[model samples]
Target: MTDATARPVRSSPRPTGTPLRAFGALMLRDTRVLSRELLPFIVRVIMQPLLFLFVFTYLFPRMGGGNGMMMGGGSFATVLLPGLMAVAIMFTGIAAVALPLSTEFGVTREIDDRVMCPLPVYAVALEKICFSALQCIFAALLVLPLAYYIPSTPVLLHVSSWPVFVAVMILASLVSGALGLTIGASVQPRQIGLVFSIVVIPITFLGCVYYPWALLSHVRWLQIVVLANPIVYMSEGLRTALTPGMPHMPVLAVLAGLVGSLAVLGTIGVRNFLRRVIS
Candidate 1:
């Protein structure tokens, strides 16, 4: 017979750890995987900008006997410097999250296993965005030094304010990550290529990457129209910080656009992620 005074022992708490710990662990795992794929990652980030710079800034000038002038009068490479960085950031973010995520959400349903971590489902989504943002940062930085070395003509980059430069880099990276999440969640695996063809190409061509927004006076309607593209702000914002001697959008508008884009995209991505997971 059990002793009358003996009480039932309480069970121990779960060893699952806190949500933040799980979130960090998820990111760490992704980081480890990325470390193994370093060669491919470097190749993917550098190829587009390197080839474009080689052709346009180096070969084209030698072929054409001159370079195109930017809006406020600078070498094409000057314009391309910030613009290419922006593209790298945007493309890296999309590739980091959207491409793999589409496959995970496909027949594999690998995303289900990821969401089953002890952390909240939204935290899992946030992990994707945050890690993608980090890759965006790295891809963008890789583009930065290339501008100095790649162009036969000088790529003039004058950073008047380091704080502003850093801030734009961060906000723009996050915006791209959020945009990636939205794309990843909305587009099925089969349809993602279509997204790049229709959505991404159009936006990039129209995003004022090769020119300044202020120079669009000749095409006022098109200028007004392209403002709707988040990439416009990124290119413009970077142009402002990196090439201050050149004309750029108002600082207020750049900051506002980045903030607004982040908010809108983040909300939509989280909602779509939740719906996809729950359904």
Candidate 2:
């Protein structure tokens, strides 16, 4: 063969901007997938929060005069609104990321495609977080009206610290997403039900969904246990932002702990997920 014919043709170098473009495309693709699968996720996210709203905001106010503000001290509805909204974000993050992750890692082996993407392993994990965080925002909006209408007492919906509220909302979603990643990577697909029964229940009860960490002082030991719960920080942080008058954990301390814990847990989850995929 001639020297020219023997030489192999080289393709143009891959685009230098491929990573950003790919990341955006990946985000949009996941968003479309989530949109199609949204109904069940929405239902699951809203159900438990709604139940708590009705029982505490609607029922308890009439029966016990607590309305929604931490067993009758503050505006029960107002207090529960932010706290429960935080809880809903937590649930949405878990349901959107964790449950499907187990399935993808198990029955479907669908995560293999994600691993094959040109992005770093962390990008795949980040995609999960981004997808679930979007759901968290949606769930928060869906439950806001309930927060407004359900309480018997005159409830406030102050947003004096709009920036803080938004920041805390994002923080709450990140914490939940990190927790979901850890749980998703740690559990077997068949054992996810066990997570719901044990992990989810304990987190919801101990997470300050119904009361602030301050009120838990009466049960000091339980308080310590729940103080370790990320949800407590998220709930308290959110409540503080929404209700300026409500007492809460020191914002700096709670935010620091939550962000730090999420970093640690999320690192472990990424390592675990990468190992699982490669194996």
Candidate 3:
């Protein structure tokens, strides 16, 4: 006999939207947030590159410091323009991913909300990387015209091959984004400032932003050591594609190194992100 007091069981309904739809919604939300902060974003994007161009490319040259002079008669502005663009890409990529990640993993705990969304954990990581890459590309584009024209020293930008140029830019952005993801995942919030001091400073100065990698041939040990830096490949790749006459790393080597970095760093970053979220 059935009991008169028996209660009915209720089952939760399954979530309706496709994973792609969820991913799109998340991306759209992020895009809106980014748009609202566009003015600050533009300031952050333009400040360092503009100053670097102003000081080294314009002020110093006008003051007779011969800032535009390089060994073998290469234009310093030409060499610097690519490196500046690389710096823009790298800095923007890293900051875009890392800063918010620090907050998300800290007091705000916003990442918890993201992880709760109907998406795979790895998809969240991929979203961060793709968004950061887009920001890096935008930063690069914005910096290019300013770097080209603002410098009192004339910059000779001769695109040897559009395909190669585009390839380098794309790869550079991906590598920087991957690097940001890895760093953001690995570092604790308290140590973020220290990471910037120790990791980022060395990367910027040693990345060959102010000079061509070929100049380092005289200092063989230094040249070999700086090769470990991803920015070397990025700067040299730009130099190779943009100003062919400048002595830069071999194109094949740059491509191979960037691809390897993307593979290793992207994997590690996603794994770390998953662990962070799950924990």
Candidate 4:
């Protein structure tokens, strides 16, 4: 009777939903949040590119700057368009991942909720990368049309190869996303502004945003130095894809560099993110 009363207990099995489902759920949630903030996102995405177009492509040309002479006979607008697009994508990726991550890792402690989910810790970092990459793509699309039509100086853009253009855009966005993840995970909340000044400012100006990478050849050492800046490849890749007739970096080199950057930065970012979350 005593033995019968002490019945065996069975532990319940874990939940049945797959990692895919969890990832999808998290993505969907992020999409919904993005949708709600669509207006601000659009404004943020558009503002910098708009200023660049207005000042460099429009006002400067009208103010006696030669329309195309600055960039080796290619229309300044044409040269600038791709660089501006790269800037938009880069900024989108950084803002999409970094700011929220800072807050989550800061006093809000919201990251706990995310890590507590059924998904693996690395999946959370991956979700950030994917989400930011998508945002970067969308930003690129928006900037492309605006860049083509909005400039008062007629911009001549010819896609030499659609495949190359697509490849550059996708690869650049991924690199940007990975960079954002690494920066987000590594920077403390209080040092965010300093990091931007020290890291982001130099990247933007030295990124070949206002000029072509090939133009650096006149200053031999600069050409070699700028090669280390990932954005140079992105800008050059876009220049190659969009204006193949103009001087640009070799396509194979750009592609190879981007792939390498993605691997290294993505690995470091995920490891740092895991450390931050687990600690």
Candidate 5:
């Protein structure tokens, strides 16, 4: 016979929380998990952008790779700064949302725990998007310092309008999160790797990240084609806000693209998420 004192203590069950509380709790859970993996998170966020800046800004310029490698003979670092930040934000959203969501939805079934929360299913998807946006914002902040100092040339940043800068950052981050959500909900776990190859690669290369979009006037047809890429707006938008000296798309067009993409991607992501959860 076991002694009463030796037996494990049972905790009382708590009621399912209200929707706002549930949402906050879910966000908190993600925060705790990320905190535990802080090292890996930092590495994942910094490695690519850091290496890219080092090679292109520091090494290539020093190695007799002339201003031809630069953007219109201005400092490459200035052009690269906004672009790298955009890439950082985009990468963070996909990594934070898509990879984990696919695994949880497919193999681990860990999503069930979150789904069983008292909140609505669409709320769940929104939480994922919101959380990923937070991460994207944070990832961009992390890249900012690295982009500033690591380059051989000076990185010039002049925020023409504070409100525009703030608006673009928030809107662009939401678009990225929504895109990640759509991919996570729609793609099968086994085929997720294909997303990086087909979708991610093409978008990054064509995103106007390495150069100004206005320069693409020489390739007018290609310019029209790349406008379809959401990331083109992101890179150009950041260039508008941070590097006003750089050639970028109009503020109106950038805002329009981001808002439209957010609406489209967010709707599809929520619908797909609900279907996946119910099925």
Candidate 6:
């Protein structure tokens, strides 16, 4: 037999762009799975933020003592609604996605199933980010009806700066997702509670969610510390975009800060996730 006839020919390499296709496939598959798991995810994302808005905005003024920020003849809901939206998005990443990721990696080994997909490991992480970001978006929307309901006065939102508000939400979601990835990969399932107690809760309180950065000017050290928190920038940016009359930081700088931090943290988290997978 002729050698050419006897031996099978090798196929040429597939296109280098195959990784992107593979990446897209992974994202689609995970999104499908995520949709099926939506109910509890929705509940978890909405619960805390709703509770806070109900108790603080609705109950506080009813009981008497909340300043004008409560909607009843107050601007309380207007100033705080955007920040609460951000907080809900942030918690979707930290509590809903991150803690579960710790369990998938440790107890159930579910991350193994994800890593087994025919794509770069980074693509798997990207899918996770996309899923978590969707939850963040959902959480943001869920807060809307509550925003109108809680304040005794009318809730007024100036949505003229939608362009910058969109930028802020995207940047905040990316940062929160990266942070979830990093913390998930680093901690064991047993230690996730500690992470929530130490890292997540502190970040939330200091993130400038309840008030504008200008309001924190009195505590110079606290202001300096919050400058390092991505949430502060996100909350302040959202306020600037959605409320022109409110005091806030520069929208451009805050957006830049959030995007920059997301890039840095996301790069590190993806690298670490890859290492964990390969190990």
lDDT (CA) per prediction: 0.90, 0.79, 0.86, 0.87, 0.89, 0.78
Question: lDDT per residue, candidate 1, 64-170, as tens digits?
Answer: 77764444678888887888888898999999999988998999799999988898899898889999999999999998777788788888878888998898999
Models sorted by lDDT, best on top: 1, 5, 4, 3, 2, 6
lDDT by residue for model 3 (127-213), tens = 888888888889988988886688877787788988878888889998898889998998998998999999998998999887888
Clashes within 3 Å, all models in order: 0, 4, 0, 0, 0, 7
RMSD in Å for model 5: 6.9
CA shift of 139, model 4, Å: 0.5
Model 3 poorest 10 in a row by lDDT:
65-74
- Candidates 1 and 5 compared: the better one by TM-score is 1
Q: Per-residue lDDT of 176-209 in model 6, one digit per residue for the tens?
A: 8888888887777788989888988888888888
For candidate 5, the TM-score is 0.91
True-structure lDDT of candidate 5: 0.89
User: What digit string (tens of lDDT, one per residue) describes model 2 on residues 217-266?
Assistant: 89999988876788888888887887767767877877786788688878
Clash tally for model 4: 0
* Runs off by more than 4 Å, candidate 1: 1-9, 14-17, 67-70
lDDT of 4 by residue, 89-156 (tens): 88898898888889999987899999877889999999999989899989988888787777767777
Model 4, runs deviating above 4 Å: 1-17, 65-69
Q: Using Cα atoms with residue i matched to residue i, what is each candidate's TM-score against the true structure?
A: 0.95, 0.91, 0.91, 0.93, 0.91, 0.90
Greater TM-score among 1 and 2 belongs to: 1
User: Which of candidates 1 and 3 is the stronger one according to lDDT?
Assistant: 1
Q: Who wins the lDDT comparison?
A: 1
Clash pairs, candidate 5, are none
RMSD of each: 1.8, 2.4, 3.4, 2.2, 6.9, 2.7
> What lDDT would candidate 4 get against the real structure?
0.87
* lDDT, residue 209, candidate 3: 80
**TM-score (C-alpha) between model 3 and the true structure:** 0.91
